[model samples]
Each structure stands twice: as C-alpha cells, then as structure tokens.
Target chain A: QQPVQSPQAVILREGEDAVINCSSSKALYSVHWYRQKHGEAPVFLMILLKGGEQKGHDKISASFNEKKQQSSLYLTASQLSYSGTYFCGTEPGDYKLSFGAGTTVTVRA
Target chain B: NAGVTQTPKFRILKIGQSMTLQCAQDMNHNYMYWYRQDPGMGLKLIYYSVGAGITDKGEVPNGYNVSRSTTEDFPLRLELAAPSQTSVYFCASRGTGGSGEYYEQYFGPGTRLTVT
Candidate 1:
C-alpha cells in the first residue's frame, strides 16, 4: 500500500529545522527517501532498512521505525539547496515499492 | 558513465496507439522498474524486473507491458493508449547486495507521454 505523508508542505528559513513524516498501515521492509527539484528526476537520498536505523548525510537524515511502520526525514539547518519535493517510498516484504505523495519543502535564505 | 538514460524525452500519442519507453543502465544493476507520476502526485509503480526473463506486475500495472531480455535494458510498452495514460514516466535501477535491503535507486530523466 502507498504510505501517507504528513504536512504536505513545509516552509522554513535558512538554518531552521523541518521534519516530514511517512507512515504506512502495513509493515514495511524498507523505506527509501528521495528529493526532486522542479522538472528533474528524483535523486536518491538514503535508504533505511527494517532495523530502525537512523542514517544521515550532510545535514539531512532519516529514521525508520519498524514497529510503527513509519519513517521520518529530518532537514537540519535547512538551506536554499534543500528546496525540493521530498518523497518517501515504502517497500513491504516484496522488493517492489509504493511511494507516498511527496512533501514539498521550500527553504528560503 | 551515464548512470541511467531514457529515450524520446517526450512524446504524444493518439488513442489506440502503441509505443515503447526505453530504459538502460550502465551500472549493471540487476533490478529495474517503471513508474508513472501524475502532476502533483507521487510515482506509482507500473512494472519491474529482478533480472533477465523475470518480470512482475506492480500496483498500477494495468495497460502496460514490460520486457527484460538483458540486464542493462528494460522497456515498457503501452498498447491502445488512453487519456488516463498521460503522465511522466520514470525508469530506475539499483544495484543490491548483502541482505538486499540497500536498494538506493538511480533514476533516469523521465519521458513525458500524452494520449489524446
């Protein structure tokens, strides 16, 4: 099933923090995070496995809660380059994934 | 290396027409997928392949067919196109290892298709 994302849109000033949440009704095997700029393909950010591991790169990070079948993407000290739509794709036991409707994040300087 | 490439960046089709969207990866990834995204919406998986000669349907596979004769190429075919098929289609692939949980995908630029 497709996961559900909260706070469909986020607006933040530079150096501010924002959180986007994704939750699924069914158990998730893995959660993949991506960022897409206008008129461009989505770029992979990170993948959180079923172990509830929290992974980070630069100022961005994500956490997956296996028990809750949910994942959260954290934008720390947001920057202008972070302006884009954030998507969370959830995969069940199967390898195929179902993506949640994206959360549009606009970081202004 | 071109991580992933798609052909005919954009196209328009008439009702009942047919065409194929080509996808290729030079990374030698073993998994490929096709997804369609409507404006202001998330992508929906249409089809996927684990390897050559192994194809499977995803959540939104209707009105679409796919083939994977080689690991580097995966093509999606649309027959008898309809208006509802108009959307941006993306082709992605990832190299998986270990427990098969690290599937960070590489996506192509995408092809925008419109059916009238």
Candidate 2:
C-alpha cells in the first residue's frame, strides 16, 4: 500500500528547521528517503532498517519506528540547495518499495 | 562503473505506436524495477524482476509489459502507446533480499515519453 505523508508542501528560510512524516497502514521492514530536484532522478538520502535507528547526513536526519509503521525526515538549518521534493518509500513487502505522494520543501534565503 | 542506465532520454510517440524502454545495470544486481512518475506525483511501480527470466507485475502495470531476459537487462515495452502512458520512466536495481537489511536502489536518469 502507498504510504501517507503530511504537509504536502513546506517553505523554510535558511537555517530554519522542518520535518516531514510518512506513515504506512501496514507494517514496514524498511523506509527509504529520497530527494528529487526538478527534472532529475530521485537520489537516495538514507535508509532506516532497524527500528529506532536514526541516520544523519550533514543537517538532515531520519528516524524510523517499526512499531508505528512510520518514519520522519528532519532537516536542520535548511539551505536553498535543499529545496526539492522529498519522498519516503516504504518496503512493506518483500523485494518491493512503494513511495508516498511526496512532500515539497522549498528553502529560501 | 555504471550503476543503472536507461535509453532514449526523451521520445515522442503517436497514439497506437509501440516502443520499448531499455534498462541495463552493471552492478550485477539480481533485482530490477520499472517505475513511472507523473507530473508532481510519486512514482508508481510498473514491473519488477528478481532474477533473469523472473518478472512480476507491480501496482500500475496496465498498458505496460516487461521482460527480464538477462541478469543485467530489464526492458519495459509499451505495446500501444496512449496519452495516459506519457510520463517519466525510471529504472532501478538492487541486490537480493533476505536479510533484514535495507539495500540501496540505484535509479537511472529516467526517460521522458510523450504520446500525442
């Protein structure tokens, strides 16, 4: 099933913080986060497999909750280069990943 | 090494025309997938293969067909193009699945298909 993401779009200023959440009705084994700029392929940011493991990159991080079947992406001190559409893809079944509708994040100066 | 590659970066097709979107990976991955993304929307799976000669339908498989003739290649075929088939198509590949670990998927730049 497709995961649900909150706040279809978000606007942030430089150095601001924002959070995007994705929830799935079914249990998930892993949650993958990807970002896609205009006219480009989605690039993998990070993957959360084990429950309660938080992965961080630069000013971005993500947390996965196996019990809740949800995941959250945290962006700290957002930069203009961070502007893009973020998608949370969940692996509910074996060998397949389904993505959420996506949340658009626009970081401005 | 090229992870995953897709052909025909852009193509314009007439209604009822047929074409194939080719994909190949040099990572020697056992799993390959085909997905389509509409304007401002998330990607929807079209088809996937776990190994050579093993293919399965995905969420939005209608109007599309796929073949996995080799471990390094998986191609998506549109027998008869339609306006609804117009979208950006992406090809991805990953290693085998079994352990409870998350395998990263490498995606191609994608093919932009337009049906008139």
lDDT, candidate 2, at B83: 98
lDDT of 2 at B61: 95
Candidate 1: tens digits of C-alpha lDDT, residues B6-108: 9889999999999999999999999999999999999999999999999999888999999999999999999999999999999999788877547688999
Q: For model 1, name the residue pairs that clash.
A: none
Cα deviation in Å at residue B6, candidate 1?
Answer: 0.5
The first chain of model 1 has a TM-score of 0.98
Off by over 4 Å in 1: none
Residue B1 Cα positional deviation in candidate 1, in Å, after optimal superposition? 1.9
- Number of colliding residue pairs in each model: 0, 0
Index of the highest-TM-score prediction = 2
Candidate 2 residue lDDT tens string, B1-116: 98899999999999999999999999999989999999999999999999999999999999999999899999999988999999999999998656665588999999999999
